[model samples]
Target: MVATGWRPKAGNRMPSPSRLAGLLRDGRFVVTAELSAANSADPEATWRRAEVLRGSVDAINCTDNTGAHVHISSLAAAHLLVEKGLEPIMQLTVRDRNRLALQADLLGAAALGVRNIVLMSGDDVTAGDHPEARRIYDIDSMQLVEVAAGLRDRGTYLSGRKLEQAPSFFIGAVENPFAPPLEFRPLRLQKKVRAGADFIQTQLVFDVPIFARFMAMVGELGLLDKVFIIPSIGIPRSARGARYMKEKVPGLHVPDSLVDRLEKTAAARQADEGVRIAVELVSAVREIPGVAGVHLIGIKWEEGVVQVAEAAGLLPRPTFSPRASVGGHG
Candidate 1:
């Protein structure tokens, strides 16, 4: 119903695996929904929303300047979530920011006890609708993940200096299940893992069957055990949302049927249609074997995300009391 949930109970083991992907490894679903608001200042509002949703979901997924349309950095927003006591999987955009800034952000996150991160190459700066914006790419997304993983693993900074304490982040990367020739996605995913990626989240997934096939291939790679893979799905609200994603966001494609649905829905029913589509897609996502959970991207539909979660049967949920469960196992 609300964006932020209740403060997580103390000493609950913070959920084992710590990373978004690892959280989903045990066959439990993990949802990484986006709730970052347009304004970057004061994440408390969205962070609170994240807390509320975290109860029903495994992890909260934040985006980094998603599609470069408008919004605060995903890392900033995720830090806000962290401050609010939610486990946030922040997206690291490896486009404009350099390695130094990225490393700093990582340290800041670790200092705040924020674990779990998602690395992305990010959309082109020119794509931001701000033609005057400059793009600074020191490294690609995969390279960024590799660097972060090495630092987190080796207790050293990129400069090769040992740190007082190495960060323990659950590093994640992205993939597009709908990438052309789809055959190449597995190889790309493998490269990321070999480079030290612990888990992965994929691009917008519209077709469950296509995603199932992607999972089957993932199983073949033995990655299911070593790395966690979850797919992303967006809640299309306006014709503008769909249009922007289709025409601007690289590596993201909205199926025609959904577009057609949006086209046909009356203005008054558009919101309901969006919720129904998200619920149906999310419900289907949870059923995918090895799927950690669904990442709901409802940038403007913050409240709508709650409705979708409820409709998807992911809410009215129990607190994730790892201690109680661990004792039960014992």
Candidate 2:
């Protein structure tokens, strides 16, 4: 179940799910892995990541310097990915960007045939490599949803110019199903819905029954049909990786049993075990009612994500490699 609560803003427009709902019906889960471009300016590495995902997943989600990890700009990656024939979902991070930059990126994504996007306030700048880097939160995630939707429907850019054709995108927002105060999860999601989010991709969800309960509460609010809920599953690799996630990432929790298993296993085999667990998680969630699909967060273990999707039967065997599509000047 999903919740709704978005309000119209400047150039007010009615909310609709025409874009994202179609992707959900397509039946392929959107696998979101961090693009490892060592340098944000290099578009080649970003293209390679998108190419690999194109072979294994239906859509590629690019993060805006996710957690300050190494990568290209989320918008750049999304643009390249769309050009490479894969669906692109740009992560619209409001933090560290001005209103103009946000507007440009949104228009850029739309121009490139990226029909969906995910809005996020973003992780603290301290979480990134350059701890001293400054941030510019000109608008929060909810405000972003309102602004993007408003502009898209009005057939004009934020600058008030007419478009050859108004760009349309299926907008989404993040949700944490395992919040400390579970009661607030529904209300919070409701706010995003009212803010014009067409879909929701939840934070790392491990406990299935708890997630189901959260879905039930969302249903009680009578917004399920109006919104699509896609839960994200993070597949852990090394002990260092698991530890760093649990201790460093906000709004993320790693279960003890899985951590114990990772600790007991050999370092070289940890990624394999982690992928197996992720496959199990996805398989279980597929049976739950009202679930749209799983969004896999592979971190740096991209190939392991392919294995997890294969194990979950989300990808077909003997997949074609998109090698020719990468390495060209982006």
Candidate 3:
């Protein structure tokens, strides 16, 4: 059974006032891990994976049709995590939903006690298994952030109608620091902050120096103080995996040096090297001035997250008072 007091009911005791938000506000280094929904109907595997990350992570991020492939809904997956006494960061992409659907889902997620949300303009359908699927772009991610913030701050919808009970969500947005036209990236982040992003999670960052430069630019613009910046860290399982990420994935910049390091390592030991690299990156990133946290994306290699967190000295997360309530319509 799930732990007591972690249930999403109104009167149940809360462990903390949203661990991610609290950590960011208190200037503490935060750690979050992504938990993608399984393609199958059974949730046992997903729950088991989440169980392993309980004490090591601050929040579990539920992906929304990641890579445009359909899976269990992110909202449903987040609800499952909540049932298991784990905090979930619900990801909502604008690729499939219109304004009405988005608003409805936001309200439903809030009712289910999901406190954090990551907004994105999802990957194109052609990139997924179902290339023939029709795409919807009713509103982009920026507008979605504005819409969510409007509900929280002003108790109103984008249409100017006031909400009787606005959903309180800790808004988040995704960034690709290694994306082309490098200089424009920080400007894009500033736009999201202006649109009301409470935090920003970046894409897989293998180029530490480039990411550091990006952070420096962000700090120069004074955007770091406006929003919590969490760089995404990935641990490739093999040299082939690293090569695929560097060559195939758009907006992902896995440096050639990392690839060479992985290639030179014995085939059996490549995974270990990946973990070491992740640990090194985490340690290096922790020293960077503007980084509020690290979001570890151990795609299919969940156990590696534990190894990286432990090796990087990010385990044994701080415990907060149970008196703090998480997400709700304020």
Which candidate's lDDT is highest?
3
Model 3: which ten-residue window has the lowest total lDDT? 1-10
Backbone clash pairs for candidate 1 read: 3-49, 4-48, 4-49, 4-52, 5-51, 5-52, 30-292, 32-61
Give the TM-scores of the predictions, in the order they appear: 0.84, 0.84, 0.91
TM-score of 2: 0.84
What is the Cα-based TM-score of model 3? 0.91
1 versus 3: better lDDT goes to: 3
Tens-place lDDT digits, model 3, residues 1-330: 011111111211122256567655555677899985787768786798788888888899999999888889999899989999899999999989999999889989988999889999999888899999878889889999989888877778889999888776778899999888989999999999888777899998888899999989998997755677889999888999999988988778888999999999999999999999999998888777778789998887789998999988886887762222433201
Q: What order do candidates take by TM-score, descending?
A: 3, 1, 2
Q: What is the Cα-based TM-score of model 1?
A: 0.84
* Tens-digit lDDT track of model 2 for 6-110: 211222333222223443433323344444443646666776666666566656677877786546677777777767766677887888788788887888777
| Predicted model with the maximum TM-score | 3
lDDT of each: 0.69, 0.70, 0.82
Any runs in candidate 3 off by more than 4 Å, and if so which? 1-16, 321-330
Clashes, model 3: 0
